[model samples]
Target chain A: MANSSDKQNRLQRLWTWFWSPAAVLSVGFTLIAGFLAGILFWGGFHWSLEMTNTEEFCVSCHTMETNLGEYRETVHYNNHSGVRAICSDCHVPKEWQHKVQAKIVAVKDVYHEAIGSISTPEKYEERRLKMAAAVWKKMKASDSRECRNCHEFEYMDFTIQERRAAAEHQRAIDTGMTCIDCHQGIAHSLPTGYQEEYQKISEALGVPKLGEEMTFSEAKSDEIRTYLDQ
Target chain B: MLQILGMIGANMLSLPGILGLAFGMMTRKWGFAALGGALIGLLEALLFAKFDFSQIDAIEMVISILIGIIACLVGCAIRRKGVLI
Candidate 1:
């Protein structure tokens, strides 16, 4: 009985304390301090997020050596304009919400790394098709958003492009086809049977048939044929 | 470069540590303050580190808890002395 009374007394005391007004420090000072702390916290979180987005950070995992080497050979790495698109540029989203979501999802990669899921070259090759399919699915769903960050259809000068390139780009824009549709092997080597894998991913994503989606433009057909032949 | 910068940014002005201080200042109860700081540290470490706990993470958590306790004691002392600032 005495213990129960003591508990009640303690609870009453806590309730009173909770309702009591602050005895020290101005409200303005507390608010300012909280605001400053918020800024610092946000800055720190952003710094860490960007840190994980670096190419160096991506390649730090031994399993990424294969992809890194392949990426190094791509035009994205070495171009005529001396511009470079690093790992994050191609993979991570730039928008705040999507970037945070991508980061959270990427924790699975850390789990895979810890478990050595693709630690060996052979293991990586074995899983390449599945992994590439996942990325292709994401890109297709997002309309190849990362690619459009730099390569916008409106900015392209089809007049100066190769005849075949011009025709293809025009067709892509007309059909609303994204960059990844035909540029799968541009950045990395395509896995064996990638065509079948991609077809499956497309069907699952409810995407229209790739080549049959829209009619091809007839403009510059002869030039495009000659260009392809050459 | 990014790793170094990130470590410096996160470690130097630890959000968890500051939160712990704020919790301590508000409650003026060392046990609650320390518990809150530890819980915050554990959540941050687990989420950010993704269960890849390191010695540095553990040390940071301990430091935050200590900071909470110290801040709570300081708040209690100030209240006892009726020092308004």
Candidate 2:
């Protein structure tokens, strides 16, 4: 009976100690330390996400490396004209149901990257052109919801400059020029590596000059306005 | 520097543990205190959005420090009172 009573007294003392102010303080300190550790480790997690997002990741084959550097430096990185669409942004639909469809389409890119199919600039350009055409077709059929997510009308309608630019945009569209024709360099800078080849092809095939000549500032103003109106 | 202030502010706004201390003290319930602290931190993150404090200037740093210290004290007091339980 004495031993049992002693054990009960000891257990009660332990329980009180556990719920004391000092114990609470210790727990708080431990939590604070853990929180700081999480913040420190987040950088690595963010870097991994960035690596997976790059176009180069999608085109990892040897043949694609030649053009990878140029693509990295493209206007898509800058997102100047507001129509800047990355490979996934355009190809992948926003809804969960369309995710599988996007993955299936992306498989071709993975195969090309893995199999070293595109050997030359010509081959790469051909594939890019086909992809661009498909994107254009999709844009025409729908509102390009993915692009509009970041470049929304309310977000774009912020300044006096944006408003003046919108008037010029209405005129441009009325003249049969779509947003992409003038804002071609929105995704990639003007005078791309493919420019000379594209010009040569235009001349050879008697294809009318599809792009317009505009200064960067003027182009940016017009693009901003177009986005505001949309 | 502004960056330091920003970081401190971010810590105050995002650190659930700091708020948890107060909640725990107030309620005298550790679990609720932790949950409340976490919820407040998450709410701040969702509403204001979190950015790198290293980009801000010295003024912001001082302000953030003031805010963080006050928050910490309040949280500690609440825990001591055991009102939350």
Against the true structure, whose lDDT is highest?
A: 1
Docking class of 2: incorrect
Candidate 1 lDDT tens digits, B1-85: 3323333234324545455455556664566655765676565555544466642355445544455445445554444344243
Candidates in order, TM-scores: namely: 0.64, 0.36
For candidate 2, give the lDDT: 0.49
Please state the error at residue A64 of candidate 2 in Å: 4.4
Q: What share of the true interface contacts does each candidate keep?
A: 0.00, 0.00
Candidate 2 TM-score over all chains jointly: 0.36
DockQ for every model comes to: 0.03, 0.03
Candidate 1 structure, TM-score to reference: 0.64
